[model samples]
Target chain A: MGAIYKRELSGYFNSAIGYVVLAVYYFFSGLFFYLYCFYRDSASLGYVFANMFYIVMFIIPVLTMKTFSEERRQKTDQALLTSPVSLTEIVLGKFLGAFTIYALCCAIFLVYGVVISFFAQPQWSVVLCTLLGMLLLGMAIIAMNIFISSLTESMVVAAVVGMAAGLVIDTMSSFSKLVPIPWVQFVLEKIDFLNYYTNFTYGILSIVDVIFFLSVTGLFLFFTVRVLERRRWS
Target chain B: MIEVKNLTKRYGKITALDNISFTVDTGEVLGFLGPNGAGKSTTMNIITGYISSTSGTVTVDGSEILEEPKKTKQKIGYLPEIPPLYIDMTVRKYLEFMFDLKRVKLPKKEHLDEVMRLVGLEQHGARLIKNLSKGYRQRVGFAQALLGNPPVIILDEPTVGLDPKQIIEIRKLIKSLGKKHTVIFSSHVLSEISAACDRIIIIADGKIIADAKTDELSGVLTDKRQLLLTAEGSAADIQNELKKIPDVQKVKKTGESDGAAQFAIEYKPGADIRRDVFSAMTRLQCPILEMRSGSESLEELYLRLTGSVKGGEA
Candidate 1:
């Protein structure tokens, strides 16, 4: 698992994907930071956090698209699967590799927060809470995208499907409002990931929301493992 | 040692491997001879735990592969039909990654250097795999399988795309490795198998058609031995004289060249009729120019067993 993790993490940087992902992420986040904080002359990061939700959803699939898809396309999965490692280890190693990159992207927000601190005293607790929420949300989405990547050999298909799935998860609450059926609305509200995410932006660190994101992350990682195992059987 | 029993693999309605069972004893070079789509790679995949067998078990070193994959996989090194390579990585880095992935206990730098040297990749270590030729990439794959020095090395068509020189080098390496490791090498080439393996298993249509020692497979498949004789004499006289020798089942004038007759003599197996033929030729005053014994070549035997050629004894 350690070896796979190291290889995967370095793989992102070996090609242009890692730098490209970070660059795209930083450009958007920097633009949002300037618009929400500096141009407006405010210390609040709530608007930047809220607006970057959709950007995170779109950008993360780029990081996770080639996780398993490239390996399958190149037939490198034979080496990983046939090695003396379990399915769990391979899945987790890949998950953590992607997660580390996403975490680095999120860490840029800290520098943004520190910059705001010099101009005006910001709510550190609220800022920390939003960062935690962003990390958890990124974890869940990265895990889900890795699962998408595992289902196909085409990285393009994985990215498109991953973005579609992310859009679905992010917009469930809005879709629920449009639905007239009360039961469907209630179910969508119950499963909406954005609802849980919105709480942390306002400094509400609910344990239930944390658990919800963690469960989703774990569930998708499990699904990725199952997909690999099923391929072997097939 | 490896033991595969009752192995059957089916992809939907198509059966790839059909109830095949075989075992490789310790320190044996077992060549899996088969034509394309003959379950050679499928069988290797199952034994190496890359895939699961539908209705059978593969036991490596004492444990079932499916039940204890880590333990079983540790003892076997597999090179699939396509060398699974990361072309973006340098050859050295790729090998180092594999060494770590296999968790070798040997000193890392020395072991990797030895493997690179063994595969003749020492000079190309720093080059990206994408830039190397096909033969070099294959050597890198071979080096990967040799990383941990596992007891069982299973290579599926290791010399498929190599040039004649590289192929000979790899065959020699495999022959040398057979001295210590139990090797299962698969190929469609008949001479490659006959030259490198101690025992041969010929598979066709997912069935074991022939299995015997390298020298014995021809004798096992062919019931008659033939000798081609060229002599300066009348064809009729040569055939008549050759038929008089005991165990000479049939003698036919095959051809005439430079006014010399070429007679093909079919004899019973295990019979030495050369001395009798020589004496008869001296008595008939038909001076012998050339005489050579012929058995079924491995190529002919392979074609016959694979059902490529029909209605003739190999």
Candidate 2:
């Protein structure tokens, strides 16, 4: 697992995808930071994070799309599957590899909060909670995309399907608004990831929301391992 | 040692492998000979635990592959037909990654250098694998399979697209590795298997048609006799005389040069007509220049057993 983790991490930087993802993420994120904080004279970092979450919906797939598809396309999976490493290790190593890059990009956004604090008295605890929420959101989305990559050999298919899935998850809050039923609306609110994310944006660190994100991430990672193991039988 | 028993695999309606079984002892090289789509790759995939068999078992070193995959996989090194290389990585880095993948207990600092030297990749260690020639990439594949010094090596078409020189080099490498490890390699090339392997398993349509020593496969498949005769006579006269011999199946006028007619005499099963042919040539007053008895070559035997050619009375 350690060896695979190291190799996959280096693979991202060795190619152009990693840098492209970072540049796109910061470019849009810095733009939102300027518009929300400077142009509108608002000190609340939550608005910037709320808008950045939508941008991440598209960018995380770029990081995770080639995780397994490229290996399968090049036939390198032969070397990997025949090795002594277990299926769990292979899946976990890739998840962590993509997660590391996502975390690094999100960490850079900490500068936005620090810069806001110098000019106006922003809520540091609110910023911290929002950052934690952003990390969880990224984790859940990255894990799901990794699973999608395992399903196909074409990188384009993985990316497109992953973007579709991310789009549905990111916009589920709006989806709840379109449904007017009281009971269905209640369930969709529970299932809507953005509603859960909204609580952290206001400095509410609910344990239920944290477990919800972790559970979604774990479910996808587990599914990815099963998909790989099932391939041996097929 | 490796043992496969009653192995069967089916992809939907198609049965890829049909209850095939074989064993390879320690220090033995087994060649899997078959035509295209003959379940050669399927059998290898099951043994390496890369895929699962629908039923039956494969055990390596007394442990079942599915039951104890880590131990079984650690003992075997597999090179699929495609070589399974990361083209972006340098040769040295690839080997280091393999060492970790195999979970080698020894430090890989000097061991990798030694493997590089073994596969003749010492000079190309710093180069990316994609930049190297096909032959060099093949050598890198061999180098990775030889890493961790596993006790069993399974190669699938290790010399498919190589030039003659590269083919011979890879064959020699496989031959040397067979001295210590149990090796099983698959190929459709008859002469390659006949030259490199100790035992041969011939499969056609997912069934084992013949399994014997390298020298015995021809003898097992063919029982007819072919005699080449060179006699100083006219082609018509020689043909007439050869036809008189009993049990002669087909006699073809092979060549004629300098008042000599060469004919190939194929005999029916259970017929040793050499004595009759000799006496008939002597009575015709034609001097016999050369006479040699031979069986069918391995190539012909392969074609016949694979159902590409129809078999005769024997």
Candidate 3:
């Protein structure tokens, strides 16, 4: 598992995709920081972190589009799958590989938080909470994309589907608003990732919210392992 | 040793492997001979724990692949049809990754060096796999499989895309590996199987049609023995003289060159009329210039067995 993790992480940096994803992610992140903080004279960094979710929606797909699809296409999965490693280990290794890259981009967001502190002394607690929220949200989304990546051989298909799935999850809050039934709307809003993420921007750290994010991440990783196991039988 | 029992695999409505069973003793080189879409790869995949069978079990050294996959897989190294190489990495990096993936606990440097040397990739370890030629990439894939020195090695079409020289070299490497490990390789080419394997399992249409020693398979497919004799005589006179030999069922004139007639003398089952034919040819004034027997080569038998749709099972 450690070997697969290292190989997968190195694979991203060895190609142009890693650099391109980071550059595109930070460009928008910097742009959003400028628009929400400097140009508008806002002291709080919540808007910058909040808007960053939109950028994450796009970058997560690129981060995960080739996780398993490329291996299958190149026939390299045979080496990994036939090895002594269990299916759970293979799934976890790949999930962590993509998460590390996502985390690097998030780490850059922390630098932005520091730069903002030098200017306006934004609330440290709020910034930390939002950073935690961003990671949880990103972890769950990355897990979902890895599962999508495992289902196809073409990277394009994985990317497109991942992007679509991300968009659907991100917009679930508004989609729930359109529902007429109060109880149904309540359930959807509770499950909507944006609803859970919005709380951290205001320094809201409910145990339920953390559990929700963790559960989503765990559920998707488990599903990914099941899908891979099912492939062996198929 | 590897043991497979009644392994059957199905894809929706079609059965890919139909109740197939075979075993490979330790340190034996076994060949899976079959045409395309004949379930050769499917069986290899099952044995290596890369996939599961629909209704059967594969055991490696008494560990069931499904129940104890990690233990069974640790005992096997599989090279699928296409060399599964991460093209971006150098050969050395790729091998090191494989060692780690296979959980090799010993010192990595020495084992990797030995594997690289064995596969003739010692000097090219620094080059990225994408930059290497196909033959070199294949060698790297072969080198990856040998990393942990597993007890069982499964290669699916190991020489499919190599040049003639590389093919021969890979065959020799496989033969050498057989000295210490149980090897099972699949190929549709009869000559490759016959040359490299001690036992051949001939499969057609998802079923094992024949399984025996290389020479014995030819004997099983052939019911009658034949001799090709070139005699310096008229075609009709040579045919009549050859017909006079007892147990000679049919004598046909196949060709005539320079006034010498080539006759195919087919004998009844379990008959050796070579000396009698020679004496009769001497008496008939038809000097026998050339004599060749055992007309049924493994190649012909393979064609005969696989060509027929109703090719019987062994």
Candidate 4:
């Protein structure tokens, strides 16, 4: 597992893709930090992290496009799958590798928060909550991308599907008004991934929100394992 | 040791393997010979636990692959048709990753040296797999399978595209590896299997048609008890003279060269006619320059064996 993780992490930065992901992530994240602080004249970093959650819908795919898809495209999945290592380890190693890059992008958010404090008063507790929210959001996005990556050998298809899936989960809350049935709208409202982070961005740590993100991540990873396991039998 | 019993794999209606059963004793090299799309790879895949058989069981040592896939797979190393290489990775890194992949633990720094030495990749270890030649890349794949010293090594077409020199090198390597590992390599080439495998299993249309020692298989397919003799005589004289011998089913003048004649003598089924031919030539005062038996070769045997498919009874 460690070997796969190391190889995957190195693979990201071996070409321009990793640097591009980090550059674009930090560039836009810094741009938002500047806007939320200087343009809007706000000292709270929660708004910056909140907007970053939306950025994840677009950026996470870049980090995960080649996670499993490229392995299949290059025909290397035969080696990994035929190895004695269990399927769970293969899935989790890829997840953590992509998550590491996401975490690296979030690291810039910390610098953003630190830079914000230099200019005005900002609570460290809310900053911590925002950091936690950023990670949870990124984890959920990574899991979804890993699952999509497993479904095809084409990296383009994986990226497009992953981006579209994220948009689906992110925008699920907006469709609530269109639903004619009250129960349907209620379910839609509860299904929003971003809604879980609203409390954390407001410095509210709801146990339900933590469980939701973790469960979503776990569910997708479990599905990815099952998909690979099924290939051997069929 | 491996035991496969009534092993079958079906893709909806197409049966990739039809109740194929074979057993390999400890330290035996079994060659699986089959044409394309003939279930050679499918059977290897199932035996290695990379895939499951639709109905039936594969047992390695004593544990069933379906019941303990991880443990059973640890006992085998498989190299599929394509040497599953990560092109972006260096040869060293690929081997390192495979070591972890095979769940083999060694001293942090010693595993690489061991594998490189075994596969003779010590110098090319630092090169990217994409940069290495095809032969070296295949050696890297073989080195990956050699990691942890697994008892059973399954190679699918190990010398598919290699040059003659490299082919000989790989054949020698497999022959030496056969000394210790229970190796099962599949190939469409007949001479390769005869040279490297102790036992050969020929499959056609998803069934094991013949399974026996390589030499024994050759014996069963060749029919002979007659001899071709070089005699100084006219064609009519030799034919009329040889016809008088008993058990001579047919005798014809085959060809003439060097002012001597060659006669192809065929004996009756289950009859030894060499003694009669020699004695008749001696009595006729004709010198017998040479005599040789006409028999089937291994290549002909292979063609005859795999050419026939099972009847479509199902």
Query: lDDT: which candidate is best?
Result: 1
Off by over 4 Å in 3: B218-299, B303-314
Worst 10 residues of 2 chain B by lDDT: B305-314
Q: For residues B1-314, write the lDDT of model 3, one tens digit per residue.
A: 98999999998899999999988899999999988898999999888887889999898989998888888899998899988899999999999999999998779999999999999999998999999998998899899888789999999999887899999999999999999999999998877887788889988777888888877864665576889999898888778877888899988777899989888788887888999998988888888899989566555666676664353322
TM-score of each: 0.89, 0.88, 0.88, 0.86
- All-Cα superposition RMSD per candidate: 4.2, 4.6, 4.4, 5.7
- Candidate 2 local lDDT, B174-251, one digit each (tens): 899999899999998887887899999998777788899987875564567788999997779878988988799889
Could you tell me which residue pairs clash in candidate 4?
Answer: none
lDDT of all predictions, in order shown? 0.91, 0.88, 0.88, 0.84
The full ranking of all candidates by DockQ, starting with the best, is 3, 2, 1, 4
Residue A18, candidate 4: how far off, in angstroms? 2.3
Write candidate 2's Cα lDDT for A201-223 as tens digits: 88899999999999989999999
Question: Candidate 4 chain A, which ten residues in sequence have the lowest lDDT sum?
Answer: A45-54
User: What lDDT score goes with residue B129 in model 1?
Assistant: 90
DockQ for every model, please.
0.66, 0.69, 0.72, 0.56
Candidate 1 C-alpha lDDT tens digits along B278-302: 9999998988999998756656777
